[model samples]
Structure formats: structure tokens, C-alpha cells
Target: MVSSSSVKIVSKCFVKPKTIPEESKQPYYLSPWDYAMISVQYIQKGLLFQKPLGSIDNLLEKLRESLAITLVHFYPLAGRLSSPEPQKPNSYSVFVDCNNSPGACFIHATTDLCVADIVGAKYVPLVVHSFFDHHKAVNHDGHTTSLLSVQVTELVDGIFIGLSMNHVMGDGTSFWKFFTAWSEIFQAQDSNKTNDLCLKNPPVLNRYIPQGYGPLFSLPFSHQDEFIRPFESPILKERMFCFSSETIKLLKAKTNQICGTTSISSFQSLTAVIWRCVTRARRLPYEQETSCRLAADNRARMYPPLHPEYFGNSISALRTAAKAGELLENDLGWAALKLHQAVAEHTSEKVIQMIDQWLKSPFIYHIDRLFEPLSVMMGSSPRFDKYGCEFGMGKALTLRSGYAHKFDGKVSGYPGREGKGSVDLEVCLVPEYMEALESDQEFMSLVSL
Candidate 1:
């Protein structure tokens, strides 16, 4: 197991939004997506469990005190979006609420596993599900806003803590940093040595200052419609899948052999296979069609390794085109190569610089129609297992993406460190396509290997 000290902390300085008067001085306006992300930095969540010798009230008091230094922004819509600018100050307040009576705060001091378990299960879904709801519409202010909510639920035998935040506020990396800090505070308070914990500097906020003109600059739609609209939907479903680590390694090795190309990473190869499998199962026409886009995190490419603590939205997308037939007909090597090229070309400094420019353009949103329908959203090599799984009771057997709406396909893959060549992939596809792929002998063989 890795020690917490070894984990890197990202800076959070830039996450705080400047006052309206301060922001008006700048010539450029924050893209709608960026504006929403900035608001996420001010929100916070805490988990209070009943330990063998602990009182829940004591824990809550300690947590409230410990978090005093950080600003806590809250909204009334527990699972919906809130306007960025509230008509009145203190329109919404942040306070703890119990499951039995959500409007009233509950402060109980007890230690019970059953209580913890029920709370944990409920909290998990509550925190994750809220994001999808908030993104669907703008708040009362007419500006698109995101809400942050905290729910306390009972786990199977212990209390589970859940935090829900808007994606526009911060990306996964930034959110993780906030979580780790919160955990550290809780741990320090539990041990009665809060002063020993060191607080790091916050992240620097560098607005996407446009560089030379790129694709986003001449786009056909508004900035809000481009990135935010893709994620809007009223309802969503969640699913989870687990694969033995050994199976993933074998598949990667096989892909390397078939592709005859050492340049492809395991992630690219796996995504290509999934794309082909889904398309074939759906019996979708492949000729001259581009049906998918990959959500690539631009962290490393933008500034070497991204600081985990740097909060706010710092991501970009890469578009790929291929006929369904070509992907299915190609060997693993060919598919892997195509995937690699599609991803790699966009990793260049030029591409990132171009994206920064496009986001700043007033016409950024107008270009959405030029692209093909985005069928799948894929993210590879996430470090879920290595993150905070240990803090929650038993080790997490599997980590999967929460339910998401809007997109027809979603998949995330991460390496399993314990097993040789093993990878963990969580896929979300339409029921029909999922059923067809499950029944396909060739597709099953590839995934199972």
C-alpha cells in the first residue's frame, strides 16, 4: 500500500472566483462551462462515522471547526442545479441534515456498523447522481449554474459519506484533492493532533487565455451549447462490471501482437475494441461514418504532470472518425494504431494551444453541428483503486462510473496494479448493444482474454 504522504497535492489558489467587479476588468468572459466549474471550488463535503470509541456529535463539531477556514457554498435543491448568482446573500446555507429529516440537522453520537452501512450505500449514489441533474438547466439567474449537495446515509454496517459537485466546478483530479484534504482533517481530528497537518498553497487560476486561432475559434455554436449540452439529460442509469486483472494483461499483449505496433498504449487498444464491438452489435452502418469521441484529459499535455490540487475545469475532447466496418475488419494492431494516432495527434502543444484559443472565441459554440454525433465517451487509465478506497471499510472490489445521462456509450479503464498485465474497465452502453456484445462469440473472446 502507498503512504498518503507520497501522494501529490495540487494547488487550489486559482479555483476561487474573483468578485464581479474584479472580473469585469478582463476583456474576455469565462466560457459558460468554465464559469460553472469555478463555483465548484467553494463547495465541500464531510463524512462522520461512529467509530469504536467515538461520538458522532463530537466528530461533527470537530469537522465543522476544522473546515472553518474553507468556504462552504450550499444550495437547497439537494439534487439539482442552482444559479451562479443568488438574488440575495445567504439565500442558501450549508449545514448537516439527517436522512430521517433532511431539513433539520441531526447530531447523534454513537458507534454502530449497521447505521454506517445504510448511510454509506445511500450517500454513494446521492453524491454521484446529483451532478447529472444540475447540468440539465440554468438556475434562476439565467446563468448556467451547478449545485453542490451533501447527503448522510446509512451503510450496510457503517455510516457512508457522500459529496456531490458540478463537473463544471472542477475535474476529477481537483475533486480528489479536496476529498483527500477533507479526509486528512477528519483523520487528524480523530487522532487529536490537528495542528500537525500541513496545509499547502492553493492552485493558480489561469483562464483559458486564447493563443493563436484554432478549431474552436470558428465553431458554429455558443460556448455553452458545445461542452455543456452534450451532458444534459433528465434521467440516467448506473451499471458496474468487474474483470480479473490477469484477463486485461492478456488482452493487451494480444493487441500488441496483432497490431505489430509498439506505439499504442493499452488504453487506446481497448477502447478501439469496445467501439467496434458496440457498433457491430448495433448493426450500425459503418461506411463514411464517425460515431464516437474520446474525452481526453489535457492535464499532462498542458503543463507536464497536472497538479492534483489545482481545482477547476482543465480538460478537452478529441474527435475520431471511422467506418464501423473498418474498425471491425481490422486486426487488433490496425485498430490500436488508428486509436493511437487519433489520440496522439491532439496531444501536441499546438492542439492544446489551439483549443485554448477556440474556447475564448465568441463563436466557439456555433461549430458543434459540423462534427458527427457523439455516441461514446471514453476515459482511460484512471487511478480509482489507488485513490481513497481504503478509507471506506473493506477495499472496493470494483470501481465504476456512476450513472450518466445523454451519451449512448460511456467507458472508463484503469490499470490494476496487483495483477500482471491486468486492466479494469467499466462500460456503459445501450441495453440492446450490451446484450448483443455479450452474446457475440468473437467480442466475448477478445474481452475475456
Candidate 2:
């Protein structure tokens, strides 16, 4: 077993597209939502793959070749985030400089660690950082010149593909789009016999949200057009708890019995249980108001209805609230009902209202609001089929977010590997709170260690 103390970097280099796609030559506009994200690097996602069907060198070569080909279709990733002309004093339009830029940094590293060394550990995996490229601090422009970066780390028994993308560039939806494309290219061996690769479904780049939303400058939130908060040290501990198909079924059935209705989904049921447990574990006062923010993907809910391939931040923040007393005192159904209603309220018109609101004030409400007590934000999708990414290799052994998710109270859920109605919760909380959650009898009963 490789000692957990050190992971060695073998090589590091930039891989630009063989030729910049013509479409990428123009500057891609940043919508109000995109602009809200410029100051914070909110998302860094990663995946771990076991042995592929080739030698380590051959696999790395194919990965690099396929990545170059894939960058052609997703050209925006190959560019840098830039600020243009002085529309106002110290005020400028922040847009992606897609013209000429060095492509993403590709990192190759080796770790004596095994995949199981982290994922299989008893204490909880804090080793997610081993899979990422080096994070370079931003320059004076207050924007990261690097939009996308890749780090491929070789473990004793597997490979980890870490992708780090700026939130301003796009959201999780955009990240997954590029991920799926790279996966396809890798599987098909993007470099054919002669080595030519292109995306079959090129992203329909839509910078504007189909409304007269103002660009990033119009937002009233930040002064000098930026917020550069020092990176506070994070005190986070993550533990994965798997809820089997049987437990979920029981939760669903129990929730229906408590609510006298069966309309709530398994997701709603589990979210309610988690909220209640977290609220109680945090020891918030009975009267304290606690909220769970469910990220609503609005690709299909927009007015014109964005195509599934439409790229950009397409998230609608949906929230459900309850006092700690009411949350813990009542049967789980009440919380489920609140959560269900919160999600159900996001009709097409509601999405348009959110759009217009951003047009009015382009700032993202959730960026700096994390770490607040009594607030929990949901971060991924069990239904997004994250399990399907296979690049000439077996599927990922276990896919998880980077260490950036260590913010207090951020909760992530994905379908369990058992597949029949199972769910897994990757919960990050204070050490004591996590201990409380682990000791929670009702909650622990449903969790599989």
C-alpha cells in the first residue's frame, strides 16, 4: 500500500487543441448568472477509474489525444476568463476570452495509494485532493485565466481523472456536458486510425438566458466589481453512508403513512430525514429556522425550453424551511411535504421569475451563503447517470466531489451501486455534528456503513 503521506507529481504540461475551432474564435458572453460566479471558484469535480484496457503510458497518451480532440467541440473550455472595455470607471464587461489562449493544464501524477485506501477507509475519506491539478492563485484581474484543467493521477491499482472548472464558466450541468463528451471521445478513441476527433453533439452555446438580463456589471452586490475574500481554512470531515433499497423503501412507505399520501418521492423522503437529523445534530435551538436548498435544474423549464445540450448555469435555488422544534417534533412527513412543495413550486413561470430576478440583480444568492448555521445545500444528482462515464476503461469505482465540498452543512446524494432503489449520502459536517449524526438511532438504522 502506498503511504498516504505523499503523492508525487510526474509531469505537468498544457495541451491546447490541435487547432482552435472557428466557433471558439469569438468572445463568449457571460450571462448575469455566469457573472455572479466570477469571484468564487465554486465547483471542482472528479472521477476515479480502475484499470483501462491498455498500458499506463498508452492510456495516458490516449487520454491526452482524446482530450485535445474533445476540446475542439467544447472550445470555451480551451479559453480564458477575461475583462473587456471600460463601460464605466473601474467597471468592465467580464467575458470569456475565447480567441487565443493556452489550453487547459493537464497533470500527470503517481500515487502509491490505492483507490480503496481512501474510499475503503473506516474514518471517512479526506483524500479527495489527490486527484486534482495544482490550483494557481488568481492574478490581478480578479478572474482566473484558466477556465478548465485536468489532472490524471495514477494509483497502484487505478486512475483518477480530476476536472476543475471555474463556476463563472458554467455550472455542474456544463461540467457534465464536457465530461460526457470526453468520455465518448475516449471510448471511440477520438484519434481514429489517422487520429481525428470531433464532438457528435456540439454544445449549443447560449450566453444569454433568452431574456434581457444585464451582464455581470449590473449586479448591485459587489463593489469594484469583485469580492476577494481570503481563503479561510476549512474544518471539514466527510463520511459516506449508504441507504439500501430496503431502507429507502421503508422510508418511502413510512413517509406515506405519516403523510397519508404517496406522492412524495424517495428523494424527498431521504432529504427530509437528513434535514431533521442534521438540524438536531447541530443542536440548533428549537425556534431556529433551518433551510434545505435543493438545486433545481431548469434546462427543460425555461420559456423557450433550452435544449438538453444548451450550456451555462441552469440552476434554480429551491428552498424549504422549518423551525428546528417543528422539524424534529413532527413526523418526517411534514418535512417531506415542505420539501415537496418547495420543489413543486418551481413551475415554468417560476423559472422565468428567477430569470427576471437575475436580470434585475445578477448575483448568485448561494455563493457566499454556505457555512451558515441551519442551512444545508444539496450538490449533485443521483439521476444524472454519473455511473456511465467509461473511457475505454471500466466504469468509475466511486465518483466523488473534490475537497472544496468540505464547507459546513453541504450534503451530496447519489444512487447507491446496488441500484435497485438505493441511495448514498456524502455528508460533510463538524466533527461533533458528524458524530451526533452517526449516533442518531433512527438515522443510523437506515444507514449502511
Best by lDDT: 2
Q: Please give the range of 10 consecutive residues that has the lowest summed lDDT in model 2.
A: 134-143
**Per-residue lDDT value at 147 in model 1:** 37
Which pairs clash in the backbone of model 2? Answer: none
lDDT per residue for candidate 1 within 21-112, as digits (tens), equals 23222222233334433212222323334333355445445544444322221112112222222335332211111111122112222222
Q: Tell me the whole-model lDDT of each prediction, alpha carbons only.
A: 0.44, 0.73
TM-score of each: 0.64, 0.91
- Candidate 2 local lDDT, 1-449, one digit each (tens): 23334677899877777667676777777776676565555466677788565588888888888888787777777777666556555344666777667787788888877878867875555556656653423221224456777888888888888888777667777888888888888878733632646566778786764544443454443254355443433577687889999989989999989999988989889989998888888998888998898877888877677788877887766887888898899988999999999888888899777667756555543344644565887777776666667776766877776655456788887768767878888888878888898889889988886
Model 1: how far residue 289 lies from native, Å: 1.5
Using TM-score as the measure, the top candidate is 2
What are the C-alpha RMSDs, in order, of all predicted structures?
A: 10.4, 2.9
- lDDT, model 1, position 95: 16
Candidate 2: which stretches are off by over 4 Å? 1-5, 134-144, 190-201, 212-225, 230-233, 364-366
